[model samples]
Target: MHKGNFKEMYLNTEQLDLGKFKVATSETLYMTVVSMLFVIIIGLILGLLLYNLGKSKRIGAKIFYNLLSIISNICRSVPFIILIILLIPFTKALMGTFLGAKAAIPSLVISAAPFYGRLVEMAFREVDHGVLEAANSMGANKWELVTKVLIPESLPALISGVTVTVITMIGFTAMAGAIGAGGLGGLAYQEGFMRNRPTITLFATICVLVIVFMVQWLGDWAVKKTDKR
Candidate 1:
């Protein structure tokens, strides 16, 4: 539907004016959930590997850790926007196109995984050394140490880190909107700036701020519930 000037856009608060925005919000939520799942899963794996390597005394472990460290640093060092544009071709190859929520996953996962991975490593490291020693005295294997000791011990911090990662990823989704990923950011840009509809833009901004606040409150509550210390 053709929208008139800003005044008409504000006066006409019908579904037609909001249809695309609703779709964009759905797309944004889908992308955030999927991307966050990838981040958590992949980050846990990488973090476990790094933590093990750091705790080991073997030469091969050191060599492998160095390489992994370099890779993780590089991924985190590059700005998100540059990473998205640079990886567009790869994302397209992976998802069949460099637009829409699906296409945004590659860059999101690539960037977010390393970020969360660092947190994971730190969380595990924060586990008490005495508990680790006790586990070792009990003849627990590496798997047992991780499952029964490291993970259980570090869970509170891990939850907090993941919460922070989720909040960060929400912002990333907005940035991804600039590349046709269809989110609040894209809606604000297209409808507000391009079409000069401040009402739509203000509404989009409010939606994002609300989401961030909701996520933060939920995260804090979860963290408090999980934290026994």
Candidate 2:
């Protein structure tokens, strides 16, 4: 291709409206941030329960742990696109529609939470056993042990894990867009892919990369600040 043609291919904005681009970007951000909040909260709770239950000698706890483990594994194993389709009814019931940015949040949270929950469990596992023992000797109750000891000690890893999870969510947002979720992904699919406008797709991909890079930078900063060791 000639230089002029290449320039036109990328620089042509006649079909790619700036206003729509801005809206798509905002929608993507909204979906990612909102879904991430839920993912973190739910994932943390699931992780804590899994860890505590797995450690208990009680048969009931063990049975519950096994059941939870199976569920988490199934969720993590499902493909994101299939998961979205499977969740359409739930999303519609919850949001009253399954075709917009808001509707995508439920699927995003459900898809990511189990993955993040496993990461949280790993982070909790990495906490120094010696420190836990010390806390136990000091008569730290279960709540205190979790709140003050486990979370604080595993914070760096937790942050790092969340960084990865957030980036994954960013990608999930794009996939959500494919089905009219109204984000960069939708823009890419509808305008770029379906309409044969490669420039728009390229633009959307670039925007996603920028968001991922920013998240990575911020996550690294947070990990460094929190990692006292």
Candidate 3:
């Protein structure tokens, strides 16, 4: 009877170590914010490049899309763990270490950039072609069309795209914990699971859940506020 008491042990905790919980949560939030910033900057550049290249000619545009599609496919094909491992050397060179929040930035950015780029590309694609034509009809230059028409029209979709990117980064940050990257996932893995501390594990899980839900709520609010239609 005593041997089957795992469930009881798991649920016996009254609370978690708040300091560990806070440190882990802050690391996760940092990683997600930095990754999102990189994704936004890189995604915007890629999207603009696609748009510019696509507008040159019918054949050229198809070629551009095909190239981007292939790149995206390749990046997407690599699993995140493998990608992180593969990038460890670069992370070290850039960050002087590859086992903490700073080191995880490149991997997070590399993983999410293609993702957000595609989102941005698709968001821009959703802009009305006729509106673009109308902009051109009004002598809107390329930059003007991009800033005034394309981006504004797709602001809501872009916000949604960022939401998706942030959520994805949260998952990635959890995985980064294996490399001594401090986050709730890492805390759960190292202190809770490995050390047999159920209270710590439960606390970490709850923290992640709260963060994810909060991000989702904020994202929904931003979409509603930005949506023109």
Candidate 4:
């Protein structure tokens, strides 16, 4: 593996930012959690709508579903770095500054939401068709079908998707640091690559890895709990 030319020299440990470890961990967590809330909420709504509309026989519902599908595809297709740059103005407008933890949330959601939205749709699709037919035969209303049948049935899949989306966001959070977003990635960029302090950079990376491991462990537990089948 290429360790890069800078690794040949000793790092200046004194140049490390002492607060970086805490800031990196905090920023990454904050951005990941906050953005995930929005992603799950919006993704759920969009997923349900997409599924219902596509199932409907009405021409208008079909049109709306097609439009929504197109939009989700476009959002998912955009790269995270470009999406963050494009949303910088909006983030600044909303949070008054797009440089820190809060500023990074907007981009993180844009990058994760559509991805999770599709996951939600796929999860919902996995529900047994016989169950949906039974619910409908019993005159279950739209809300009942969605709340009782769709969501509950797909909970396990949603749990798994949440894990994947959150992990992806953590990586994006690091990339956001490249643009002064103030996370472990940013700390690594500044100390490891820019300052050429390899030790500080390596430490910041390990911190990220540990956090990812914890998240994965918890997510796996949740999936196991939710998956009765």
Candidate 5:
């Protein structure tokens, strides 16, 4: 292996455009934020629905739970690269081309929604049954029990779950870059892997690490701040 020169690599500026960095970073951030919003909305609703299913005796809560469990398991089990390719046709059709950040959004949303849905389900499950019963005793409707009691009580866990989802989306975004989406990953691949620029690759790697760590730290602090226990 040819060793990369750290000093030369750090000092080089041939391909280091701060503006492009800003643009790429902005696109990546937008993708993460927007996709996460969709994930939370879809996941939370599905999770609450599943939680209600588990509570009801109508169609055998056990069976409903098992079916959802299986579907979630299938989605979570697929490798991301394969998943991206699997969605390529749909992505191109939906966005007019599967060649950039916009193209990547569909796959990101598809993959993220199911993952966070399972996490949200777990978060909902963690809510105390007594609290739910008390809410019901006070004449709380299903929506009231969900929004007022279940979601509020699970806020800390939900934040933590969002943290996990963000970190995972960072990875997915990187993978999406390999498919022609222009982000740090795509930048790294173009400048480093394909063009033999070790400096760019190293910088991209460090930036991703920093972003992921900062997200986790912020998440931890938020959870701690909100936790009453």
Candidate 6:
């Protein structure tokens, strides 16, 4: 392997334009934030449904739980890259294009929501059964049980799970960028790797790492604030 000069690589600015870098960074952040909102909202609802249905003794509820579980599993099992390709038609129909940051939102949400839903379900399951029993004995309704008891008790775990999910979404954005989604990943692939400019690739990678670290810090802070125990 031909290892280029490190100092020259770092100092070179001929190929790395700050303006384009900013645009790519914005695209990455946009995709991640937009998709994360949908993922969290939809995943939370799905998780709650799975939890409630699984707890019921009714045969119909059991059937529905199994059905949802299967679907969620299928979504989670598919790789994100293939999922994006598979959803191209849907993306075009929804976003009017399947080749930019906005178009990547549907694929990101679909791929990440079920994964986050499973995390939410696991977090809910980890809630203390004794607390649930106490709430039940006090004549708590289903809504009260979920909103006041279940979610509150599981808030810390939920935050932690969301933290993980957000990080995963960042990675998904990079993958989406690889195929013309126009983020740092696209910049790296097109302007750096293909054009033999290692500095731009390195720069984009560092930016991604910084974003991930910031996200991890915020998540930990949120979890600590919410955790009562």
What tens digits encode model 2's per-residue C-alpha lDDT throughout 188-222?
A: 99999899887898899999999999999999999
Q: Which digits, one per residue and each the tens of the lDDT, describe model 6 over residues 40-71?
A: 99999999888888889999999999999999
Model 5, span 31-127: residue lDDT tens: 7888889988988877776777877787678798779878877777788778889988898888999888888888887788888887888898998
Which consecutive 10 residues in model 3 have the weakest lDDT in total? 6-15
Instruction: Supply every candidate's count of residue pairs whose N, Cα or C atoms clash at under 3 angstroms.
Output: 0, 0, 0, 0, 0, 0
lDDT of 1 at 68: 94
Higher-TM-score candidate among 4 and 5? 5
Better of 2 and 5 by TM-score: 2
Distance from true position, residue 137, model 6, in Å? 2.4
Report the number of the highest-TM-score candidate.
2
lDDT of each: 0.87, 0.94, 0.85, 0.87, 0.83, 0.91
Model 3 TM-score?
A: 0.91
Error of 3 at 65 (Å): 3.8
**lDDT, model 3:** 0.85
- Candidate 4 lDDT by residue in tens digits, 1-229: 3355545443445655667677778888888889999999998888888877877999999899999999999989998888899999899998899898888988888778889989998999999999999999999998999989989999999999999988888999999989989889888897678976777877788888898999899999999998978
Give the best candidate by lDDT: 2
> Against the true structure, what is every candidate's RMSD?
3.9, 1.2, 2.3, 2.8, 2.1, 1.6
- Tell me how candidate 1 scores on lDDT: 0.87
What candidate 1 gets wrong by more than 4 Å, as runs, is 1-16
| Cα shift from native, residue 217, model 6 (Å) | 0.7
Task: Tell me how far candidate 3 lies from the true structure as C-alpha RMSD in angstroms.
Answer: 2.3
